[model samples]
Target chain A: MNLREVGLRDGLQLEAPIPLAAKLDILDAVAATGVRRVEVTSFVSPAAVPALADAEQLAAELGRWPDLAFSALVAGRGGARRAVAAGMADLEYVISASDGHSLANARRTTDEAVAAVPDIAKLAHDSGGRLEAILAVAWDCPFDGRTAVSRIVDLARRAVDLGADELCFGDTIGTTVPGRVTELLGRVREACPDVELGVHFHNTRGSGLACVLAALQAGITKIDASAGGLGGCPFAPGASGNIATEEVVYLLEESGVDTGVDLGKVLEAAAVVERAVGHELPSNLFRAGGPNRPRGRG
Target chain B: MNLREVGLRDGLQLEAPIPLAAKLDILDAVAATGVRRVEVTSFVSPAAVPALADAEQLAAELGRWPDLAFSALVAGRGGARRAVAAGMADLEYVISASDGHSLANARRTTDEAVAAVPDIAKLAHDSGGRLEAILAVAWDCPFDGRTAVSRIVDLARRAVDLGADELCFGDTIGTTVPGRVTELLGRVREACPDVELGVHFHNTRGSGLACVLAALQAGITKIDASAGGLGGCPFAPGASGNIATEEVVYLLEESGVDTGVDLGKVLEAAAVVERAVGHELPSNLFRAGGPNRPRGRG
Candidate 1:
């Protein structure tokens, strides 16, 4: 199974702006954990998200680890151009399924966002890059309440038809449960059978890891997690960080699944990010440590 | 499906001692949430568990809520006698399945602990109380590592033969995953088919709720949870609280499983406990609020 680390882009987007040097240190720690794929940063407007304003410079530093596979998140044609210009061949474009989150997050309607995806996909393909369309708020929306499964299925089909190579579902508010995860994966897969699928879940409501388990049971291998469980939707109030990478690794590894990532190194990386963030990250494994440690009286 | 609130006993056993007044207030809040059963306190030695030193006083206050079914935890004959004397008809007796933890937590071998159950059960039955044998460290032990499923099965049979009204497996150090949860439940059920089965899981390894899901899917309904996610084992190092009640209710209610408890009232009760504890509880739902709350840009 492939575990993609999104702590840099999705995780840091909500925190106060740290220096480029700190970002490099975190990236180095992340790479040292043997996580080959990382969402390095986003090409969003610098004024909108100052935390990731140094996306280009950080992307420039990717040459330090030529063996790692790096991807960047983009919102539109302009961001896509910047990602490709920075020599990144894998771009993730997010389109919210709910119009409420769409307008709030992308400043456009869901249809308008979908319309922009075809051009972005063409740009990515023309530049010999791969485009992954991430359907945000695919299960439940903050403003729209429960999202319609048909909306996600329709978007998945459209993204696949628009030359996108992969698709993912983002539980934007972390309100989804395992049943909904199974149903959505079934519907999306029925509609777009051959597309590689992934899931991005936040631990907002405590079902994040449960939903991840359901996704894995449904045969999904690509999972998006943040180091130290960093990152939340700045637009979604009460939302917490994405599922912690260290916790996910521990869960999968303990279940006899081969993640190929060093659990200790991941914890080390989480410690580095936690120190950089200057607060406790929302990772139970990071806080509790691993299972093999010595037991003592509390 | 029945959800038993163990925050007062299991949750508070790790926190600094709070007064009986605070405990009563928390109980009132918990009863208001429509939770019918609660493990109010434990009858262990005060020197061993000073946090629950007021077991007699706490049990005496149970008359305030006659509609709620209350239980107390006991380690052996002495604690069970105290529980019955204090007027609690339901008693939970804990026995460690692994000898390593059995020696540490109960200061006896697993066989010696099991041998005490018949006398405790006779006392409980003679006093018109029911005995729930809680098998601690059923899946993994801190010192002994992964416990043999046969050990748990053997103990379950012996506890049932000794007149245990119900059986529960305690993931003492919280090192279990969902697959292990399913396997243990299946094996134990195969051994004791007619006995009521439940699970007590710690979120120590980040799989508590997932294990809950697995147990629920495996046809077990009763679950043990802590309010505000407070509590950890003093003997089990690095272990956190049991699965949070609010998170369990949220997961069940959102998934169409009616837990018969009001989510809002549980959060209010959690708020009261959080104030009494003077620290953040580990419940993600308690911290994030319910799913229907308003959303705003961060």
Candidate 2:
């Protein structure tokens, strides 16, 4: 059970502007949890994601944690180059399977996003940074409605051909069910057997954990979770972002999966982000601790 | 697959008061969905559930839908009597398997709730009403924390011995995962072979649907859902209510299970409730629509 903490990025994206110091503090706490993969920030311009305006600064500061696998979201080729130049350990490039969200959010069609993967991959690889191609809105698109398995499979093939190291299918709008996750992951597995597959889900419609379970059953090993279920879908109206990291870690650890994460530590870090954002984060595990989690009783 | 729509009662319980006419209209729209079972309202004190204060009015009006299996929640012996006297076709008697939640929420211990089941069952039977005893807080207790499965099995046996026609286990706080649901349902099946099992899951922790899928695999045929994902657990802090009916219907229908519901009509009703509620409900199919659902080429 490999877990990627998405708090600094996804959690921050959902809130108002935070000081650059606060972002660094979140990174420092995340490092304390020993989470290897952390999506620190997006390389989009300040105009796009104003919260991530300090992406360059945070990336430079994150250099101190040399052993960590720090990633930055790259929406396009330009962002990919900027993120690579900023000394990111990995680049996560997103392409929506749904044309509506693709065109609306990324301002590029699925084909266009797929078309940029090779260049983006080259940009990351040239800088000694790994690249992961994410098929966002892979489950259901608010504009086009439900995305077909064939479309996701085709996109996975295209990204793999473009030298992507990993393929991730995202329930970008919280529109996926367990069965759909199972079916789509099965197709992605058969079509791109050699590539690593990751699962990203939102808890907007309350199917995030269900989708994660289905993905795990379908042989997916990587998952992305926000610290406090923070981020909202930029494309889908009223859609919340990724599942909470504390909740996901609690679920994984309690199920006897070796997540190598101390859920209590994750909850503590979640509290830090929760306080910095000045709002209650949407993670249940943080509010309701685990079965064996130490309360004041002990 | 059996889908019990709980929108009329559970859906309206948590929010600001909608008018009784609006409640009737919602129930009217739900009646058109061809759902075989519908939990209409609870006969609790109006002070406790202001949203469901017009329970008698709703029950009187619901007589027009003779084809639907309309049920009412009965918290105690008096609530059971009121539901039966109102001519409800089915009665749901809720008791907490955990001593803490039962004492805090229902003002009774587990032993006391178990003792009242026989009287409630008799009252329902005398009025020609079917009975289903729900073991709430079956997964975990809000006040006492983790509950033992053996205690839940003992409660199930007692409920069954009291002439209860069916048994339902609730993931009251969304604490149940797929593995736990599988184990609990399997134990219930072994202990009470003659009783039909229903799984009630809250999406609070985002594991409701996963637990539902596990229950289905464990041979539980009856599942409960609310329209628009309404209601929150009073025992479990910050917990969301039951799974969304539209999402569940979508999942079942797409997987070739016969839920005997009109998917489009349910979505229409969901839209009506979404408008009535004055906020966006957390139902994916209500917003995204299923892959096979026709929305006039968009």
The candidate that wins on DockQ is 1
Deviation from native of the Cα of residue B115 in model 2, angstroms: 3.6
Task: Give per-residue lDDT, candidate 2, residue B52.
Answer: 80
Give the distance in Å from residue A173's predicted Cα in candidate 2 to where it truly belongs.
3.6
Candidate number with greatest TM-score: 1
**Candidate 2: which pairs clash?**
none
Q: Which candidate leads the pack in lDDT?
A: 1
Runs off by more than 4 Å, candidate 2: A10-17, A95-119, A139-151, A233-238, A268-298, B11-19, B44-54, B106-109, B233-239, B254-256, B262-298
* Cα lDDT of model 2 by residue, A178-274, tens digit: 7888898888889898889998887665567777878888888799987766666333322355687777776776576778877667777877886
Evaluate residue B132 in candidate 1 and report its C-alpha lDDT on the 0 to 100 scale. 95
Q: Which consecutive 10 residues in model 1 chain B have the weakest lDDT in total?
A: B289-298
> How much does each candidate deviate at the interface, measured as C-alpha RMSD after superposition?
4.0, 7.3
